[model samples]
Target: MSFETIRQVKKFTMTSDERLFALINATRYILDKKIDGSFVECGVWKGGSMMSVAYTLVERQVTKRQLYLFDTFDGMSEPTDKDYDIFGSLAKKLLQKNKKQEKSSIWCYSPLEEVQQNLSQTKYPTENIIYVQGKVEETIPETLPNKIALLRLDTDWYESTKHELVHLFPKLVQGGVLIIDDYGHWQGCRKAVDEYFEQNNISILLNRIDYTGRIGIKV
Candidate 1:
């Protein structure tokens, strides 16, 4: 599905226009440069962003690179105090926007079965997509590709995000793109990423795709 078609189809969870642009551009970079690696998503909820990558790859006929989906499939691990803080604020805003949402939690709550169902709904071929069902700390380390062309992460909490960066970032090929989906919006996510860079003394520039998303090109 093209971007315009994706816009028209709103059944999937929310992904901002700017975020999609980053995905498309990163996909273009990998395909055009013939980046030798696969695409991976550390946290996929209902397969929205994951399918977006699959759609673009299929559209461009970039079939060699597989797309990996990593998640616990059951909500998140236990939320810490910081996670509670973020969830509390987000819940209030969500309740104000849609009273119906007050009934239950949103994201990461989707089970592995549902994620597979969601992927089956997309036009993209699933043959090149790999689904690893488990927590980031476990699945990411064990399932990392030999090289990563595009690594997009949306894992909401601190531990999960940091685990992903620790295990997978090094596998990112030089010139590969690493996109962080909840960078500016979620404190836990931001702290994990910022701390990783700081601890490593990594100087890769973070280029903003939008208020909520940022990308760094591995060099």
Candidate 2:
């Protein structure tokens, strides 16, 4: 895969949704420059977006760039009432649904195996893609290598978002793109980013990619 091929994939996957296009373009831009370091997604559900990044990298013939995908493969962890407030009613609905499901039913949460299988179906070489399975706190340290050129955070909760920022942000290469998939869509996520940046005494350079999303490049 070369830069041209990556451009083709972006063109094919283009959507009216500006956030989606920003994601594709971000991945393409990173690969086209042959950026140093690896690519990582702190919260990959079903590997949809990360797969986009991987496919683009492969298409661009990017070598020596590892793609690390991190996830619990299970649903969100337990949340307190305060956390629940940030998540809104969806959390309650999800909890209710979980209680109603049969223990033996396959209607459970996504597993790491399923995500890996999906990636394999892409026919991209397995050599460059690495799967890190576990909770964000436990998995992020292990997933992040020495340097990261592109870091995508899609964990849609307060705890997970904060954990990733604290543990993973320092590893990001200067000028690296940090894409937050749940930024403005979820209140808890928005609060997490705000609090994290505040505590660090650093201000995030937010670029509203769409009504529900934002991305920032590390200075």
lDDT of 1 by residue, 106-181 (tens): 4346777777887776556778779998877766677777888889988777788888888889898999999998
Residue pairs with backbone overlap in model 1: none
Q: Residue 70's C-alpha lDDT in candidate 1?
A: 91
Q: What is the C-alpha lDDT of each candidate?
A: 0.75, 0.69
Off by over 4 Å in 1: 8-10, 84-104
Residue 13 lDDT, candidate 2, scale 0-100: 27
RMSD list, candidates in order: 3.6, 4.8
Q: Candidate 2 overall Cα lDDT vs. reference?
A: 0.69
Best by lDDT: 1
TM-scores of the models, in the order given: 0.85, 0.81
lDDT by residue (1-219, candidate 2, tens digit) is: 434433434332222246556766887777666567788887665666666666665666664678898877775565434343333655445556654233322222467777788677556778888888778877766656898888888776788888898988888887788888767666677788899899899866989887557888888
